[model samples]
Target: MFTREWLRAVVVVMFTLAPMSVGAEVPWQFADNTRYMAMGDSLVAGYGAIPATQGYAYLLYKEGVFDKIPNTLLSNVGLIGATSQDVLDKQVPLAIDPFVPTVITLTVGGNDLASILTGADPATVLGNFQANLTNIFFQLRTALPEAKIYVSNLYDIPEIPMATEIVLLFNGIVEGVASGFQVPVADVFSAFEGRKGLRLIQRNGADQYEVHPSNAGHRAIAKAFKAVIENN
Candidate 1:
């Protein structure tokens, strides 16, 4: 029953069904393709993923989540410890100079509220975050005049103190700013609601967890953005 040809066929099938590699070609890698940039924090950087590409941005492109955008190149500009101000000051010009992105996804502001854990009061934190978000979107609008920007609002984490309040205020600011810029908001908050512990965020020490997405969580994120694209 174990013929050599049968074993060979099984091996071939397994290899064929294997996941695609990171560097694999998509549309033959042309220069004029849509420049897709991911801007914000560690979640956008694929922080917890085993391989960097296993994160949402790369998966979005690889899985053809953006069928609306063809011939694309992904530029990940997510910093590990970036805040909304960090993104405004640092990440803005990165998207502007040399290559103008055609589509952009941003995940910021959460770090601003997360700083509340560092002893900053929520009211002051919210004020500063809103100002930074406004400035960020304004600069992006001024620079890449034609890019389609998608912003993901903050989600609630049970462990983070005052997270629900922060979510309401922060997400409102995010949606408001995105609206001012005429950008669509991706519902990463709702998508991640009850699943943070199961597959989305990373597990930290006892009673503590990193707010970054796990690989499966990244896929869910990519799917959320994909749904936005599909709906629009």
Candidate 2:
């Protein structure tokens, strides 16, 4: 015996309440105190971004991707030229001790692959990278079992010799290692796959084809990370 107007109001209320129910179903939620630690190589250090702050890690902190700035704490241990081994050695110890991050984002292995350019054998480089990455995850998971760890796969630099094939292999390793730890990976590889102006090396008439990401690239990387964090 409901009137038409009452039915319309009820329908509107149901639609409004439905969204809230869906939103509540999201597994992750913002915490009042979130300790976000960023660990990795040059990309995590914000190398190509004019100012290091423009790097994707900083952007995630500044934009409050994990939590509100006032509530969230950030510890960025990302170093330029840091290979996966460096992360396993230097960064991992720090993350375990003083920082004890509640959340972590890692981007590495690009520098490990860079060794192949210096006459290092490709098989050796990939093997070492895989071992190092596996250890990095294993250590982090052991030390910070509850921490939300997110890792990014390397992007492709098609201009470099054999870069595409190498990067594909690197990403495969990343995926496999991260899967073992139940860590989510931001698909930076796909984000920059066919994109232009993302790499500083791609700039017109650049003196050197640096592999670092440009500002636009950083934003894209941040976006990719954000998507994974929000969803998983």
Worst 10 residues of 2 by lDDT: 10-19
Superposition TM-score, candidate 1 onto the true structure: 0.80
lDDT of residue 95 for candidate 1: 75
Spell out the clash pairs found in candidate 2.
none
Candidate 1: where are CA atoms >4 Å away?
1-31, 67-70, 196-209
- For 1-232, candidate 2 gives per-residue lDDT tens digits of 2233443353243234222433443212333368788999889888899888899998998888988665565767788889888888888887787657799999998888888888899989999999998899899988889899999998899998889998998899999989988989999999998889999888887645488899999999999999999998
Candidate 2 ranges with C-alpha deviation above 4 Å: 1-32
Tens-place lDDT digits, model 1, residues 1-232: 2233543353343234334552354332434656677888888877767797687876876675653234455566777888998888777877786446788888887678777888899899988988998898898899888888888886677666667777888888888878887888889889887774534434645335467667777877888888886776
Superposition TM-score, candidate 2 onto the true structure = 0.85
For residue 100, model 2's alpha carbon misses the true position, in angstroms, by: 0.7
- Deviation (Å) of 231 in candidate 1: 2.1
TM-score of each: 0.80, 0.85
